[model samples]
Target: MNILVAATSVAAVAFLLLSSNQNIPESVKPGSSAALFALGTAGFLVVSSVLALLRVKFSRWLMLAAALIFFGILGFQSLALLVSSGASLPAGATPKLWANVIRNTLEIAINAWALLSAKASTFFMGNRPNQSSEADGSAAAQL
Candidate 1:
């Protein structure tokens, strides 16, 4: 579904931003703990998105897990943003924080909607023609 794919699209954006070093705080050096954590999280999110879109029966659970993980990350970032607000920080840091917060929030919302939608449930659980007949070997026998 378009809505489900949209969630992956947001994750792709996050992956690009993090991979390009645009989202790393200036104070954090390359290969530092914080930087690595950000990159790792982005990578995990992208992987989860791919798995969710793979049309497997377990895709709903995968999507749910990704959504929950992202929600946790968003909460952590929001707390960090609040605490850092009074401190003197790089000008670019605030905008990047806000951008990530907004983008991830949107992604989480979309994932939630897709998970709850009947269409998505059906898509995830429904067997494709080939898959449905494969178990009985009818399709293979026809060939």
Candidate 2:
């Protein structure tokens, strides 16, 4: 989880750098796209950290959702770049494209895991008296 957060942060930074490059298209500029990406990543990090610190059950899921959304945007941009390039992806595009796909897929899966975990937690914790009751209900229901 920590690794995922770090990776997302790194990706956001990379996107900001790429978007800032003068050689890149104006549409891909760092203004809106980079800012949004950074904001989302930051939000994910904050939410995840707070939940984890507070021992909240849904922290992982929140982080996962954020990761998915963040990487989803990047994947969409990559696809757009490929399309705009007239399907003539760069000579070394395969490795990078596949890498991005894998990363995005992983992010999606992690997000899904988080979602499931959060849902399960919420289901058991619903209207419970306290954390102990929630835990007991969850354990009892699991069997």
Candidate 3:
């Protein structure tokens, strides 16, 4: 169980790296693409990490929302690929679409497992009410 959580954590980090290479419109500068990808991927990872660790309802909702977003992107890209004559998009569009589809698909699966699996939910939920309060009280006492 712990191994599973660790695995997902590693995946989150890998996602950071994978996202760095996402395709950007030519109109957007190269530097902006890096920054945008970093921010978006890192932000999602950080938030998702926290949400999963807490094992709150928000985490469940977040997983659902993220899946929807990824699915939407894939759907849009598939549409574009069908209709596009390679005129409007950059030459890299196909690779970019596949890259996104793969990463998003992986993330959606991992997140769903984190949210829905009882073992994962228990692992993330941690020691729950008692542990957090005790730690907080200890810190407060020290302060």
Candidate 4:
């Protein structure tokens, strides 16, 4: 799951960065270079995935950090979408906003999924006896 998240993060960031060079996505662009921050976040997420895969003790926190960033982006976009006038937005802003919102939401979900999988187990809870190795574990567990 972490691998999936990491890979998708890379791909998404790449696509956004490349596309933003031509036309900016409303959700990801707080400024001219804000997409660069998204790319940097993706880079961090990839590193955290690698660390979690290797059972690094501190990596779970990194996972949470990335998740928080995704959640913040998604949450803010969702709120903005709820209140903002679609007619006032730029041409194609609606689709770009929706796309970024969905993408960020999915990445947040993947982070949650990875946090419970066997690969990232050591990163969170220590080596305790018999934790369930559920892929998409506990829908209730969110941070």
Candidate 5:
């Protein structure tokens, strides 16, 4: 799950940066507020995901929050584009827009499905017994 998040986050940032040189989305145009927000969210996700890979306890929560936020923003942008364009392919919307929306939607679904699972929760929070208490118990038993 962490790997998925990390990979997707990196891909998103790379795509955004590379696309900035060409037919980028209007909402995320350079110098726009949306662009700044998107960049910040992407940065947060990348950092949190790396920390999650390292098994940092606080980073688990951070990654969850960052991923959800990133998904939310992308989902909103995609929906807005579709609705504004009347969901028509020939309605001034480029193929790139459609592709990006589809990709974003898929990422949202997969990440949410993985992140909300019981296994993911356990992985983030851990289920190990307290080794310190066990050690204390053994020492007491010896005494």
Candidate 6:
């Protein structure tokens, strides 16, 4: 599950990078890229969530972070689309390109964090069952 999430994150980032290039067709605009990235991110989130619900180790934070990041990007994209269609802002409207760029930046950051966290957790678990068990015991004791 961690591997799957990491792979999807990498693919999502690659898609976003490729779609950002001007050489790409206008049909593959930021919006389309965002949509595709969101799909991949959402898939990862769903899979991770299931794993977490099953009490899978190391997935809790990664899943929550991915979900937040994907939802944030989705929200930003929706707002940009609405604004582009002449939806009025109460005060001043954010520029569409800026909003898109911000969303992409945040999505990248969150994905990277999730990947790193998953990797760290895997490494930590792979070599240290005793440590994990002790930690779990302590946590349970505290509870």
Which RMSD does model 5 reach against the true structure? 5.7
Tens-digit per-residue lDDT, 53-134, candidate 3? 6665566566456444544554566656746756576777877776766665666677677667898666655655445454
What TM-score would every model get versus the actual structure? 0.57, 0.53, 0.44, 0.51, 0.57, 0.37
Give per-residue lDDT, candidate 2, residue 77.
67
Model 1 regions more than 4 Å off: 1-26, 30-32, 87-100, 128-130, 134-143
Which candidate, 3 or 6, has the higher TM-score? 3
Off by over 4 Å in 6: 1-36, 87-143
Tell me how far candidate 2 lies from the true structure as C-alpha RMSD in angstroms: 7.3
Cα distance off (Å), candidate 5, residue 31? 1.5
lDDT for predicted candidate 1 compared with the true structure:
0.63
Output the better candidate (2/6) by lDDT.
Answer: 2
Best by lDDT: 5
lDDT of 4 by residue, 61-114 (tens): 786787667566655766598468767877887778777777767767777776
lDDT of 1 at 135: 56
lDDT agreement with native, every candidate: 0.63, 0.63, 0.56, 0.65, 0.67, 0.61
Positional deviation of residue 105's Cα in model 3 after best superposition, in angstroms: 1.9
Candidate closer to the true structure by lDDT (higher is better), 1 or 5: 5
Q: What is the lDDT of residue 32 in candidate 2?
A: 61
Q: What local lDDT does model 5 show for residue 139?
A: 71
Local lDDT at 139 for model 2: 73
lDDT string, candidate 5, 1-143, tens digits: 53455456557655775674556775563455655665678778888877776667677678778877876677677677777876565755656676767776777677677767898777777523333344445674566
lDDT of 1 by residue, 17-126 (tens): 45756666644434456445655655556566676677756666766776667565865677587567745767677777767777777767777888779998787776
* Error of model 1, residue 109, in angstroms: 0.8
